[model samples]
Target chain A: MDRKMSPETRSALEKLADWFRARSIWMLHYCTGCGAVELPPSMTSRFDMERFGIGPMATPRQADVLLITGYLATKTLRRVIYTYEQMQTPKYVIGFGSCTINGGIYYDSYNVITRLDLYLPVDIYIAGCMPRPEAILTAFNKLREMIEKGEANGWKRYEENKEWYRANQLKALNGEVYVTR
Target chain B: MNLKELISELKNKYRVLDEKFNDPNHTFVSIVPDQLHAALGELKSYGWKHLSTISCVDWIDDNEFELVYHLWNWDSRSQISLKTRISRSNPHFPTIMHIFPTAKYYERDIHEFFGVEFDGNSEMEPLFLEFWDDIPPMRKDFDPLKYSREKFGERDYKVPFADFIVEEGDQK
Candidate 1:
């Protein structure tokens, strides 16, 4: 007997899952640059990030979203990959500043990885050198909407194309060259 | 004694290549590399004890590395920048760790960036760049842009005209 779920039933189940995911979001933010400063104001009484049911978590394993605050230097990117992999499925990556989008002022930096999307699947990007608390609130609201619509599928994308992302990471990180004067 | 008297005494001992009073409080004294250590020691004895910073300037045209040792006198409330030019081919300078212990980190920084070896400092390993595997980045010969391109692959950029809105007056 072939027991296949009907189209309507499957769609309804997905919508329920999306609703639950949208309501409870645990974030692990790596404060690598100046953009980390804006978070304190937003998370505090002034902006109140907790109102959206999005709160910070210490460990990656307990988190659903990885918040990359700013620039990912070659070294920090290595650690980020380790943390990202440790996270459970249905994970999201929120790229915080212009640094994560295109390396910001460190665009010409030898060690700074420019385009973050090449390495990690970014669910949402809040642009600006350091996006204000208001902008941060707006971006989070947009992210929730994306979640509700079953659109924030970065973790699924990561799973589907794991090999390509790994190759890019290795190319950027693993190398031993001649260091001379 | 005073700054003038101290510099006059130093002129009698060391080869003063050039001397300039840049500002009311800042004085620069350029000297040969051979007498750098001895001159610095005498200056320390004359209450010029504070080591402000150690900086390096690459003179690729002259094929030399200029090492500047910035010192401060608390009593006189003035700064003295002792400058010395060393051969670029054999870029080595004696560490002034005996006079200024904090110079260890500064020497290591200079060693990492400029490829200038501080002979007396045993900890010659990198200070800032931990896993750096390239030529001294601060040198004029080492092209940072080329190095960055080689190490970090850039994005294949194209014009995204669809995202832009040109104003009617600006278009003309």
Candidate 2:
């Protein structure tokens, strides 16, 4: 009666865990920008995202995914970092809109950050000034596939590269970002 | 009373430096800084009850900062833009909060962006910006692009798009 499982058994257990995790994804309803406008349509009757077993969670503590919608101003970036860190492990980060990719129209803005991946590990990036509800659903399905494959491990990357992420966060926020608890 | 009568009334009491009717509903009246308090008080009593906003313009060439107080009269359905110029170096203007009461936040906003010191407004905290190190962002001399690149890192582009112009013959 050996307590430690072999590699074959471990992988099978992981697959089972991945299947459960893939089916149910609770995203934190933290709308950081204008891209939030598209979420209402997707969550409601028209797009009906609940059918996919993906829904918005009120707190970061319970969420499996953190959806960063549109531009992140330096002021808002600090709070967002805290939120990301607070979320439980096995978390995924979805960079929504072109703004999150390369700052979009706010590329040269004094306050807006250019690249989001510098501060956090992004699992996926949905392009467009704002990706439509259909695009959002597509991204969700893609995320589900990635989760099942264990490819969407941004949380693990963040944990491993914490120092690099912290330095970038400190630089953008002018040395004023601290995640307590 | 109508705008003409109101203008005549303001002219009699205060030294109206300049007056211009931009349209039928809007008028701009420039007055000396010294007469600002009294003039605003008089206008408030005469039915210009709404203090819409206080805006500032940095006139670098003239070495002056123009503070515009936009007031609206509900009864008359007209707008008055009360304008005053302060020395750019000094950048101090007495707060109109005592008269308008609503000028407190507007004055704070002006102080944050333009570095204007509203003398009596005590709550002149940074309205929008947080932990701002450089000079007031909205000032004429402050380069936003330079500040942005310095603070928030710029995206490094490998290709020089400027040099890659497609010639007319290349299209074919």
TM-scores for chain B, listed for all candidates: 0.89, 0.91
* Per-residue alpha-carbon lDDT of candidate 2 for residues B43-144, written as tens digits (9 for 90 to 100): 888889999999999999999999999999999899999999999998998888889888899999999999999998989988787777888988999998
Instruction: After the best TM-score superposition of candidate 2, give how far the Cα of residue B99 lies from its true spot, in angstroms.
Output: 1.0
Q: Write the per-residue lDDT of candidate 1 for residues B1-172, one digit (tens) a residue.
A: 7777777888999999999988868889999988999999888988889998999999999999999999999998988999999999999889999989989999999999999999999899977674777778888888766766666666676658956878778776
Candidate 2, superposed: residue stretches over 4 Å from native: A1-11, A179-181, B157-172
lDDT of 2 by residue, A1-181 (tens): 1212233433878888988999999998568789999999999999999999999999999999999998999878888888998999889999999898888899888889989998999989899988999999999999999878777777877887789888988888877787352
| Candidate 2 CA-lDDT value | 0.88
Give the per-residue Cα lDDT of candidate 1 at A151: 73
**Residue B170 displacement in candidate 1 (angstroms):** 13
- Candidate 1 on A62-179: residue-level lDDT in tens? 9988999999988888888989989998888999998888777887787788889878999888989899999988988888888887778788778878887888787677541222
- Assess each prediction's global lDDT (C-alpha) against the native: 0.86, 0.88
Q: Which candidate ranks first by DockQ, i.e. highest? A: 2
